[model samples]
Target: MRILFGLAVLCAVVVTGISYFVLYRYVSDVPENKICGNIYIGNVNVSGRTKKEAKKLMEQHLKEDAALEITMKVGDKSAGATLEELGLAYKDIGKVVDKAVEYGKKGRLFTRYRQIKGLEKEKLVLNEGFVLDAEKTKAVIEERVEVLAEHAKDAGITKSADGFDITKEKKGETVDEKASAEMIRKYLNSGWDHKGFKVKMAVKTEEPSVKASDLESIKDELGSFSTDAGGGERWKNLKAGVDRINGSILMPGEELSVHDTTAPYDAEHGYVEAGSYENGQVVDSYGGGICQVSTTLYNAVLYAELEVLERYPHSMLVAYVDPSRDAAIAGDYLDLRFKNSYDTPIFIAAEIDSANQMRFTIYGKDTRADGRTVEYESETLTTEDYGVTYKENKEAELGSMQYAGSPHTGKTARLWKVVYENGAEVSRDVINNSTYEKSDQIVEVGTMSDNAEAAELVRKAIASQDKAAIEAAVAQAKGMSAAGSDNAGEEN
Candidate 1:
């Protein structure tokens, strides 16, 4: 019996010692209930138990209390419990096995609890496509607040004053670059307070003007003139004329037509009726003698020796201007045009006066040698003749009287060649072949007296220039001659 009791005591002692060792281990491994001086439930003070036993106790305690449940009852619905709430859920009996297991899998239980506490304390920050940790979320919120403060400092949202002012309720000044950047930063960080965001911009205005030197150079060239005799009133007239030809700038290889520069024939513009030539007849019309200006300009162009593009003459011969000298225009129908032959600009000057005189002059850079000269020569090529026709006046008796008839109908082809050189022919060009028309003939029928009387009367009428007596005597003589010719033909 003594041996048995001793063995049993020894076994009991051994069992107690093993239990104490296990409890000590459990107590040593248990997390503290306070997280940085804040009370929590997951960390509990348990002693003399294994890890499995502590876990079973923790789970049993957590299941009993409504607040300690893994799922919390909110109204009639069950919602997921927060980490902080879960940490405080377990009873304060020994160590919390659930927390230990959870923490072991997810780092320190105390650290998780503290993080959840911090999340509950910090302001929420919502970012696009981002789920931030508690610390990061707090930092984001603080940064956004700072950005918004900076934007308020940089921004001026005051209303405009009256009129053009920018401080009244009617209008407001726009936000600037700094303010706009700050607002955008705030928007990206906090996803709240969006009243100050803006896209700012600036614009500048500019004015244009012509250079003084360019204007002066143009004026000098236009004012300068060559005043020789042929240069005569022509140059003066040209100077006066171009005074009105403003805004005309001719570029090299460009063509200019007189018709483009001249004002249209409108009575409102003070254009008067003047004599103009057309189809062999002279008539009065508005803007009539402007061709003189064209012709004069043509001459000046020749003097300047520019390139002639197109030129046409009056249909009939003109007395004021030579047959070949005149240039005619019928509004857009006809125009005298030329091209700037030089590699520079040329200004046209024209003048017309009450005397029906016109002159045209061109101003350009001088490009001629001292000894260089140009001359023109003309030659007749062919003459075209129209067959003659006779006209009789029924009111007068037949008569053998000849009167100075109207102008003849014929055509003359003239070759005008221009030679350019000092004395030798450097280049020769055929200008044109001109054609002219001839006039027609007409006869009057008159009565005749007796043959002897008619013969004497015809002779006297021819010598004395007596038209009436000649007609009477010719009528008498023609009757006798016709009767005699018929008799002679019968005898034959």
Candidate 2:
């Protein structure tokens, strides 16, 4: 019995040793540069393959995977491009391939033998070859999806013979860039089957501020005013300024600045040298006649019953509008700013008609009571007569005189806005109080150096502070100088 038990134990031990030697030899038989049997690198079976051969196979798989189409859908609009077109390429796979090759070849002979044997029951699969640049991926996504983007359009108004034409507003659509890029990344890292992909792109909706319905009620002509659009370069400036301001829609509580809308008054912006008021004189400046446009718009706004937030009078009175009614826009300090205080939006229509008149017509919903009328009255509180001013001119012939500028009368005035209901007076409100500086009639008197007599006579005439006396003295001195020139010519 003892001898039979010993024989059974020896047979079992011998069988186990033979199996261990077989597994160890199998694991060791794999080429030094070859991956062990039953190992995969990212779904590409590299079992029993050299490192170079495994890399070649993985490169082929990467090419196919890169060629796979990635589709992004924004609503029903879809954009698609292959991963290669989107600048995606797998990171270096040499290390991962080496890792796979080293598997079942590490540790003691028994451990390696057991690993090689375990491959038959549970195959080794490695997650590799999907890393991509984040910025590059996002850039491609944005470029491809740009065509799917739509910008929101606000409702617009156009003038018509009947009333106004309201254009319909449109909603916008844009892609969610971050989420789209992340979706692709997450799928490639975990669930990618080396095939084409379809992603429902995250899209955002944009709303319009003034919907078509909101402009439906803005059809009435609230107020309209027409001023003389002056001629020449000033006229062209007026046209340019008016063109910028035309078709402007001012919503409720929104203010409009004449300077802001038509600024940077340079030749590039279509403005040329034209006459404008500076230092109590009319001088040539860029966008010179811009104030007339603002004044016209100011009157229209006043008649429309809009709120005037800022207004400034010209240095002197303008011939186009009343003293207190004119609105001047200079640099940034002076601007004709007004707000749409009505419950609805307002539209400004400006043009220089064939009659050489610049007109600004305000159109909006008229909520004023029926039979109610509005009018503005200008009252002169005080007035001062301008005097004659004489300045000496050395180059002119003796006693010759020239007018430098026209005289301006000084006045303190106030404007009143009166509301009448059913042809009966109801309320009167003071709009503004303005003061205009008086300018003297500037006359340049000649002071010829050779003629002391003529110079003294001109000086006495200027001191008299009389226009007629100064003119007579200038004429006499000019005649004496002419007579002396004629006598000298005859003697020669």
Candidate 3:
């Protein structure tokens, strides 16, 4: 039994040795620069081919990919990107090709036998012919997607010579970056079979918040106000008030308060003492000129046909606007308020010009028919002489006295808004019924010596109503009299 086993082992060894020799010779028989049988560089058969011949064969297939262009589409919109741009490219296959050519040849007899046998059953596949550069892919994908992206546009309003017009809203669309790249990847993995392809793109939609039709009716200047602007803390206060109200916007039925527009009424908020109504007297206080801004805006709101929500008439008549038309605001206690009743959004534009004029313009849709206009007028309902209050002094010219500025008359006034439809007064509506208390006519009486002669000269001059005679008497009185002096020019 041992001898039979030995003979069988020897027969097997000799047969195996012959097989190894045959495999080795087969491997060596391949041309120096040619690949072994059944070798593939990404489906491009290179077996039994020289290095130059294999590269040429591969180049023909690679040329197809080099010129490859893929269009990414979202709905009907499409944009194209190149394979080279997406970093899906093939290059430097010489080393891999050379390795495949020397596969079974560069090994021991047993190894060579196994390699040749294995190759006979399955072909050698090399993925080195294709490489992916991630950065390049990202850039290419974004560029292509951007070409198909549409940005949404918001609604807008424009003013022209004729009137105001609105711009309609526009929708936007875009592609999904990740999904677009994935689609390209699947196509690339197909051995770049199709030179050019169109991929189904993922799309998104964008909407606008404001619409043009929402502003279609805002076409008129409702109400407006203007006042004198002068340089000082008072002027600064008025300008600061205007700055606060500048570019203010309001929706339909919304109200704007004077106090809310001008807050923190102090030097810290840019206010300076100017003339203002306080306790029935014109006094200097912080935020003094700020009321003029409110007054101007109030008038603009009225002309624009907006509703007057809350307003207060000045205790003393304001000189900037017509009497009874002035809007007075005192801190938080008193405010000038108005509502945007035009059924659309309104804008406030306030400005203090170089010509000492502060103007407030109200812009909104004008629903007034053609050839229509509005006007506000102040009518003096009743008038009465201001009372006189004499203050005694110790001067010798007892009767001689001077009052500060001019005496203001006390009166009750009514404000009326007259609407005209096509050059005719259609109707008149009362806006304000204001009453003002008379400011006392102050007289400084000289009490130093009670000079009867100077008093007689003054009375004679007043009787004549002659300017030269009164001036001559006053010059003689100042030169001769002694007690109290009249300082008329020293008053504000």
The digit string of per-residue lDDT tens for model 3 on 1-492 reads 999999999999999998777876876665666688898887677888887887788778776676677776766677677776777655577787777778777767677767877989999877545655678866875776656667677676655677665678898865666666666665666665545888786666777655676666666676677777867667788888999988666778788898987887888988877777766566788888777888888888888888888888777766778788778888787788888776778877788877878888888767778888999999999887876555544553544566643356778999999989988999999988998777766555443444566666665664565556666766666554543344423557
Question: Could you give me the TM-score of model 1 versus the true structure?
Answer: 0.38
Off-target runs (Cα >4 Å) in candidate 2 are 1-151, 171-207, 451-492
Candidate 1 total steric clashes: 33
Per-residue lDDT of candidate 1, residues 226-337 (tens digit): 2221233233333333444423446578888787766575455445566565554456666665665666666566657778888876554444433354456676978888
Task: Compute each candidate's TM-score over C-alphas.
Answer: 0.38, 0.60, 0.48
User: After superposition on all CA atoms, what RMSD does each candidate show versus the true structure?
Assistant: 32.1, 12.6, 21.8
Can you write out model 2's per-residue Cα lDDT over 1-492, one digit (the tens) per residue? 999999999999999999888877787686777787789877878898988898889889888888889888876778888887666666668888888888877898878878877988888988775765677777776777857778588899889787688899999866777777767777887857878878887767778877888888787889989988768788889989999999898888999999999997989999999988888888899999899999999999999999999999888888998889899989999999999999888889989889988999998899999999999999999999988788877787667778898589989999999999999999999999999988888888877746677778887887887878888988887777677677877843
- The candidate, 2 or 3, that scores higher on TM-score is 2
From the highest lDDT down, the ranking of the candidates is: 2, 3, 1
Please name the candidate that would achieve the greatest lDDT relative to the true structure: 2
List the candidate 1 regions with Cα displacement exceeding 4 Å. 1-248, 320-323, 352-357, 378-417, 436-492
Counting clashing residue pairs in each candidate, in order, gives 33, 0, 24
The count of residue-pair clashes in candidate 3 stands at: 24
Alpha carbon lDDT of each predicted model: 0.46, 0.85, 0.74
